[model samples]
Target: MPSKKPELLVPLNGWKTLHNSSTVLDSADAFYFGLQTNFSMRARADNFPIKDLLKLIEMVHDRGKKCYLTTNILIYNTEMVELYQTIQLAHESGVDAIICHDLAAILIAKEVGIPFHVSTQANISNLLSAKFYQELGADRLILARELDLNDIKEIASKLDIPIETFVHGAMCTAVSGRCYLSAELMDFNPDFSANRGKCVQPCRRNYTLEFTGEENEKIDFEPYSGMFFNAKDLCMIGHISELIEAGISSFKVEGRMRDPEYIETTAKCYREAIDSYFNGTYSQKRVDEWLSRLSKVFNRGFHLGFYFSKPGSDDIERTIRGNQAKLRKIQIGKVTNYYPAASAVEVQLFQNHLEIGDTIIFENKNGFYHKQQVKSLQIEGESITNTKKMSTTQPIIVGIKVSKKIPNTAVIYKFIKKTTSKMKKKID
Candidate 1:
């Protein structure tokens, strides 16, 4: 029998990125999403409306894939009924599994006859705790993010259940995301708990230092000096081989509240890298290419956290400027049709404007990535040098030569034209 390919479990950020998930469904083995209830970690995300969520589960199951419902939030006494209702909904919706951080969710999963996976928030770092979960009938274990590769390998070797880990995206300073910094600050709201999915992210706040007294020992720290707790994002494309070797059954992506483009780009990159590594065609050039794709999204800056070694002070970024989204591409257009005989594509402008010589790419629904240059543009069959934003009635038509099979309704992204001062001076 052939060994199973490592699964890539991507996040469903919210309703806005739902369209983008189609691009990644083929690449991802499973998808985990949250709902509007307390059972989610991303209450800030759109999650899914009840009707849409049920439809989403059916859609995913129809594709012959698994869908995991995330109920990984801490449970309060008052919220028990609501939590169980969510679990029942997940069960009735035919979700393959439930990821839970709360004991209440685990008990409910058992009653609902659905399998459960312990969320990383459970802090299952050692073999004994893992055995405890397995004894509880847990189907999978998403071990804490703090476990190093050696520890993961050792644990996997000892356990029968599959092991999952966060391979890319953000990391939390607190172990297993047990954080209280948000609720303690900013007027101390009783309802805003990061564990419960309403985090204000006080860690991303900046700080500074100041002098407060006559004595030399009276030097005081300034307010808003730097992001002391702001951790860098994790990128493990370079370590794909080691992770697969560690017997990790799943490599999870961490962003669910980010832009859809970010979701599509990151998933596609990792999917290709994993396929290449296992097929014996892995190369440094390919690794570098995937890294470049990761940079196109918002990051807290990139690092391989606790995965390889003990994190030092260097792992945590202490800068005033936080890493937001860097790779911001505009949705300049979309393909309405393709003409093979002419070796061209028909795209309607959606946002921004594109010139004839601009660099852009055509992203298909199946996550196919293709780069092409704008060779021609026409409106009403008349030639034009450039195209601007247009309405449905007067959208511009772009003809770019292509070789690959472009899927119907592919998104076209115009690469931002970055011109430096020196280059501008030369042009002037």
Candidate 2:
């Protein structure tokens, strides 16, 4: 068998509701096996609470995965000490490494005896900067997104330290994310000096195009049009071999503020694609399938972006829209306590209509849905002939324990119909 492919580094910003729970990390570990928690959004000067940070790091580590703490924000004099303290705490808490952009912060990280990775914010587009970081004891360098295949190959040939590059996801119009557009427009600076956590994404806002007529007469070319700086989402899932050959050690996905389902799906896709590419049988059909799945989540339209060159007019999508919610065909029930000695399973049903012999499907951490026949039922501690009017507190007993330990949040649902003859003919 071929060697297992290297893992992708998924950076999460803890913006969506799922990132607030332990289940998100659990799901990520189950799917991706590696993650990077971004502190750029969470580490404000006033809101430097380490409770959630510690919890997230602990959960990631507990799953036997690596967690890199991001100190990749633009730091000012006022926030320097607080940032250092945060880095120190992260180091003490056994974080894998600190991702830093500022040289001063990198120095502080070095003094604290924690390994450092240069953040992409530093704009290491050339081989010299990569070499410089390697000599500075940096273990990894996130390359600027503007670099093409040739640039990557040149840098890879010269660098000794591990190189990380964005394999898929959003593209920033700014050079290496160094744009002052948000700060300049909102009057809230976000560069190397003033470290403000709140960034009003000025790039994604609307704009109106104006035209100049004869003798300085102005005309409205396009009214109230948006996507002014909206670069298309980068999708390089189709080009894995070229990237791996360019010596990229880690393929990074850029969705720090996206949903957990987005994280789960995207990470899993890249995980599989990387494996297939290395095994020498990667296909375009598989890439299309993964991209289609991603479309169901969220996106600003897809593009190959600057990976090839400066993105053309066709590379950008001019409009923005939200993804429609796709409801899952499952229902959740109250969890039960497991007892191996009694060989009995108990679950609280949301609907009281389930019979003893009814078959139902259940989902677990493995993402596999299993169908099982219920052999028996009991209410309370005694056996009951019928449980037609069961209450929420009453535990409904089943015959067989699920193959996998049912997570507290496990959802169960009975299939209403197996197949439709007409639908099958349409598919055929």
For residue 285, model 1's alpha carbon misses the true position, in angstroms, by 1.5
Model 2 off-target regions past 4 Å?
1-4, 13-49, 52-55, 189-197, 212-224, 321-428
lDDT of 2 by residue, 266-332 (tens): 7777777887887777898988887777665556668776677888877655654222223223352
Candidate 1 least-lDDT 10 residues? 419-428
Superposed Cα deviation of residue 135, candidate 2 (Å)? 1.9
- Cα-lDDT of candidate 1: 0.79
The true-versus-predicted C-alpha distance at residue 219 of model 2, in Å, is 13
Candidate 1 residue-wise lDDT at 418? 34
The root-mean-square deviation over C-alpha atoms between each candidate and the true structure, in angstroms, is: 6.4, 8.5
Give the per-residue Cα lDDT of candidate 1 at 189.
75
